[model samples]
Target: MLAVVVAVLVIYKANFPSYLYRYRLQISLSVDGQIYTGSSVIEVVWKCGPKIADSGRCGPTLDGQAAVIDLGSRGAVVATLRTGDTIYPVPHGAVDAVFICANAFGNRSTYEELPALPHLTGRRDLSPSNFPRLVWFSNPADMTSAQKITVENVANVIDSTARFTEAFVEITSDPVVMNIATKLPWFPALKLAQKGKGVLSMPGQFQLVYNMFVGESS
Candidate 1:
């Protein structure tokens, strides 16, 4: 009876599958003179699901392809796109952008121009280049109620994932704050604010800060 119980426990543990969690990246973009927010999910899938081989590493290729889905509003169907290489999701309201990491082997190219999405360009704002982890976009057009709803939905999906070590926020004030944050040893930092000294002195402003602990699997 003891032997049978132990066997059952071992089998049960072995059969249990490890669940993957998603990472949420929130980017703040200026749409039609108003600041809005959006979110996207990052998923890392193993090249050989649950299979082990003698190759030093048994994880997904860091340079492999990834998917970015845009959650629509009011339970609408989400819009998704496939990236050629592993790209990070930087969700700027109205303008959703992706960032491809610099590879030691070669560099990846992206579209020089933004995609043709409604209410994206006019209200879009550019994300800072200092931190390669975060990406932002601006749209000149005013976002409709529907667009805002869709962006919020996307945020919900991203917030549910559990696969990243750090996240970023868009600080709209002075670079001093950014400089100070990066100096901290706790975690790495990324800045998504627009150019100029505009972000330097805005007190009590809604500075976008990421919840870094969200997607940790520990």
Candidate 2:
């Protein structure tokens, strides 16, 4: 049963729009001596809301980059790692970023109120929602060589963490994406400001493999 679901997920990944990403989340965690992997996919609304009007009036687009992963609960495909949340801000946001990486469910299962109930293999008859599992915001315009070092260092730690084997996510880009990497040690933020883009893969045999896009929201 799990295999069928996973297979469907793989197909979904291949079929999502190339310009606009379908939300995709990949998580791995170690509980006691057990290792577990989790993944989900959903449609993301990257329209930037009413900011873009038919008349040409538009809100300033956000300029930021984030390196966060599922600390594990559940959201939908492509809708998992959001770039701009209420707290993260959209345009003219902060520059210095703070990376907070973790295993999808490394240690946060105690709060599930209904763990006792049967798990829903498929959310039958459910209305899809939009939200991010984890996200960090930073303005590339404000990044310093120092901040870059910090971001790289943090990414290293998370990738090498005892239980966080590998992480995955999907996002949208205005311009066609140019790079994608799943195996590398450095955070490929490419300077989080406007038009900045690059792949951010994790380190070691287990890497992050982030997709970097240029231009705007697709």
lDDT of 1 by residue, 120-169 (tens): 21112223331222211122111121121233343443333312222242
Model 2, 3-87: lDDT tens digits are 9999988776443312112323444444344455544433222122221333222121212222223223221111123333233
Against the true structure, what is each candidate's TM-score?
0.24, 0.24
lDDT of each: 0.25, 0.28
By summed lDDT, the worst window of 10 consecutive residues in model 2 runs over 94-103
Candidate 1 regions off by >4 Å? 1-19, 41-53, 56-81, 84-218
Q: How close is candidate 2 to the true structure, as a TM-score?
A: 0.24
Candidate achieving the largest lDDT: 2
RMSD to the hidden true structure, all candidates: 19.6, 19.4
